[model samples]
Structures are given as structure tokens and as C-alpha cells.
Target: MSLTSAPGPGWLLFSFGMGLVSGSKCPHTCLCQTPEVICTGKQLAAYPPDIPLNTRRLYLDNNRITYLPAMNLGLLSDLVYLDCQNNLIREVMDYTFVGVFKLIYLDLSSNNLTLISPYSFSVLSNLVQLNISNNPHLSSLHKYTFANTSSLRYLDLRNTGLQILDHAAFHHLITLKTLYLSGNPWNCNCSLLDFSIYLIVSHLDQPGEGLTGS
Candidate 1:
């Protein structure tokens, strides 16, 4: 049986954004509020430029955006919530989110992602929830892909088409809970031995708790 659990960047150029966002109105015809930017369904093809440094929440869902260029959102130091679901993103490059260390919630579901660089999210120290579900083309996760999100609590990987997980894939996720791994075709063999052993040792296999394939 496959394992399932539920329970569950860079600075610089940032100095320049501080000036552009100080008193700027929303750029690219997007909505702007005190600490949130609403750009959902605007049909944007790229990450909005000149975001306010004080923004705490950003919504970029249901758009045609294909790439999240490095430093695209790195200037928003105060950012804590981000939503980029249903886009055309094909890959997650390293340091793509360099300086938003305070981000606590993020969603990248329903994209066309095929690969995510290891350590892509190594800087998120306060992250608690993340969703990358529905990316059917993303079949593998390099070890250390989630290197530093020790505070993560909820993770949703539903419908991701993943077949195996590295035993050490989650070795550093000491606080993880509410893991959703349904809708995957897991190969239950020696490849899963370590992951399965981890589940048992972590108490994530306490009967009726994991792997409900779709």
C-alpha cells in the first residue's frame, strides 16, 4: 500500500522596490488594499511588478502566468499569504522566492509544474500550510525540496501523480500534520520501505490514517 497521511530569496533589487511601493497605487490594474493585493483572474501573463513592500497577502490565481521569475515576489518582506493556483507554471526554479521568509501560507495547486528545485522553499521558516495538488505532471520530488519548513502543519499533494517518495524526503518536517496524499498511484515495494517505516515510526500509521488511493 502506498503511504498517505492527512491530519495533518534573494534580496537586493529589493531596495529598489521599497521606493516604488511606498505610495504607489496598484500597478498592472490590480486591486490594492492596506496589506493585500487582489489580482485574481486578471489574465496576467507575468508576476505583477512593483508590488508594495508592505503587502502581507497576494492573490494571483486563475491567470495565464507561466513563470515566477526569481525575485518576483522576493521584495515583499511582509508577505505572509500567497495564492497562485491554476496557472501555467512549468517549473519552480531555485531561490524563486528568495526573501519572503515570513510567508505562512502558500498555494500553487492546479498548475502545469513538472519540477521543483531542491531547496526551492528552504527559506520559509514560518510556513504552516502549503498546497501543490493537481499538478499531474509533477511526478518526482528531490530530497531537500522542503528543506527548512519545520513549522509546516498542513500539506496537500492530492492528484499529483507521484509514485514514490524518498525516505528522507520529510526527515526535517518534524511538525508536519494533516498530510493529504490521495489520488496518487503509489508503488508499494522496497522503494516505499523507508517511507513506510517513517510513517510507522512517526505514528502516522496508526490505523485508518494514510493512503486512500483515488
Candidate 2:
């Protein structure tokens, strides 16, 4: 007489195989794992390696990345903190961060970025802290670059090489509490008075006494 064995769960095996494949397909240059959640500046020229789905914090500082990858970042819904400071990023494409709904803190400082596209922070509704300081080449910011980012409380623009600030630069930043604008060669002319007044009335910072040309 011959005996037959019981059948196993095919769906579970299929899912496990798929997960392994996904993990294998992740970029080889960077460390990608669900159990370990950390990725620092790895000299990545293209998009970052596929991160584990459960990753909560990411450290991507000091890279040469110029743009965000084409992959859908919305899948990393659990990401609550991110650091992309000190990169060569120049421009942030529209909808670059469409799916990062849980991000509460972000650092984009020390990059080669020149201008922030209008509505750049529109999708970052939960961002409470942001840093864009140390970008010496950044000359201008779009009028609505920070529009709809009501949760942002801290903004740092120290040493950004800023010469002029438009009238509506900080228009909708109602929740801003601490702003740093030192180390810049601010014109301190009539055009900057509007920004100076706004900073004073908002209790962000005090102007340095009289105007330079006065």
C-alpha cells in the first residue's frame, strides 16, 4: 500500500517567494532590510535602494543625488522621519513627495538647490520641522513654495546666499515659530523692509537696528 502526504499552503509560499525576490531586487549599493532602518549618504547616483516596507526612519544625508527617483514613495507610508541634507539636489520636481503622509521632520539643507517650486511642500501637511540652511547658491524662493504647509514650525535659512526676499515669500507660514536668517548679505534696502517688518511682527527675529544705507 502507498501513502500520500498532505498539501501545503500555496498562497503563503507564493507571498514569501515574492518578498524574497523584492528584497533581492533592491539596489546592491545600499543596505536594504526591514529589520534595520538606516541609510546614510552612500554616493548614490540614481534612486535609493528599495527600502523595507516597515522602515520608519531614513538617513540619506551627504549624497550626490540630483533628483528623486521615479519609484512611488507613497508605498513607504510608515516613514515618519527623513534626512536628505547636504546633497547636490537642484530642483524638486512637482509632486516629488506625493505619498509621504507621515513625515513629521525633514532636512534638505546644504544642497545646490536654486529655487523651490511652487507648492513644493503642499503634500507635507504633517511636517512640523524643516531645515533648508547652508545652501549658498540658493538665490530665490517661489512665492508659494511653502503654501499649505501649515504644520511647519521651524525654518532655518542661515548662510543661504539670499539677497532678496519677495513680499509673499512667507505668506502662509502661520505656524512658524523659530526662523534663522543670519549670515546672509541681506540688502537691507527698501525692498527688504517688508520682510524685516514681517519677521518683527511675527516675533520670529529682530532686525539689526537701522538700515545699512541709512
Candidate 3:
């Protein structure tokens, strides 16, 4: 099925080696520049197939996408940014981002996702920012969830209904610069004592009063 509905604009840029071009194919109900394709609020049910191959930025927020098949988004291998927040996505399967090796920013917030396969982000070696906040159903983050994202600098897990944080969940994120854990019903008792201590010792700063339910 076609993944386009109408055209709209948002602020983001995606430039490649050849510089910006004109007349590049843009999905119906979308706007395309040499490096960016914006299609927000299109009520899209699936990914658009007609977007230019060289696109570096893509916006598909406020849609009805429920699942992201592995490598389906790999078509945009050069993508550096993606925004799919406020959708119905329920799970992040393994290798879902394997092809987007250059992706630097990703936003999958406000979805229905309940599970995140540990290997789902293994291939995003260059990713710097990741947002998975507002997923009320996502309650736990496995210790190895971020084992491969050594370059990740920012992580957002706010309002995810998290009650338990695996002690080693943030172990591999040595380069993480900022983290968001507010709005979670964190049981700051014994279970989180070590994790909390680790955060303090590691100097990983949280936005504000990140954990609650002590």
C-alpha cells in the first residue's frame, strides 16, 4: 500500500555528498529536498516507497504504523535522522535498524511498544540520540539493551512506566551524555540502590529527580 497521504513540513535537514538537488521524487503528501523527506501527520499506515534513495532525514510522526519489519527501513541506508513518534508501533524487533548505520538521531516516543529486542539497535553504531519516551507499556530495559551503542550520547526513557531498571542496563553506554528517567514509577528501594549508585559514581546526569516511588 502507498505510504503517502498529503504534504507537510517540519524543521530538519539531511545533506549528502552531491549537495541538495531539485525535482527529486517525494512521496505523495510529502515534501522532499535533496537530503530530507518530511511527511508528518499523514495518517500513514506503512512506509513510503517513492521517497528518494539518497534522503538523509525522514519524518513520519503522528501516523498509524504498528510494526516495523526488519530491513524494511533499510531502503534509506543513508538516513541520518528519523522521527516516528506518536504511532502505534508495539515492538522493536532485532536488526530493525541494521541498515541505517549512519543514523544519528531517532525518535520512537509515544508508541505502544512493550518490548525492545536487545539486538534491535546493535547496528546503529553511529547513533548519537535515541528517544523512546512516553511508551507506557515499556516497563523494563534489559541489561544488554544498549550494549552496542557506544556512540550514543543521549537517551530518553521518561514516562515509560518503568518500575525496574536492570542493574547493568547502562553499562555499555560509556559515552552517554544525557539521560531522561522522570515520570517513571521507580521503586527506589534495594533493587535500584546499586543502579542509583552506579549512576552517581559514573556521573550520568538525569534531567531532574529522575526516579520516584522510594
Q: Whole-model Cα lDDT per candidate? A: 0.79, 0.68, 0.79
lDDT score at residue 47, model 3, on the 0-100 scale: 71
lDDT (10s digit) by residue, model 3, range 1-214: 0112111122113222212342246788888877988889988897765668788998989999888754346556789999999999999977577557899999999999999986778778798999999998898877778877899999999999899897687788889989988899887778888888877887777887677754
Residue-level lDDT tens digits of model 1 in 123-163: 78799999999999988898887777899888888888888
Q: Rank the candidates by TM-score, best first.
A: 1, 3, 2
> Where does the lowest 10-residue lDDT sum fall in candidate 3?
1-10
Instruction: Give per-residue CA lDDT, model 2, range 112-156, as digits (tens).
Output: 878777766777888888888888888777767777678888878
lDDT of 1: 0.79
Candidate closer to the true structure by TM-score (higher is better), 2 or 3: 3
- lDDT for 134 in candidate 2 is 88
lDDT of 3 at 167: 63
Worst 10 residues of 2 by lDDT: 1-10
Which candidate model has the greater TM-score, 1 or 3?
1
TM-score of 1: 0.86
RMSD of each: 6.9, 11.7, 8.7
Model 3 has an lDDT value of: 0.79
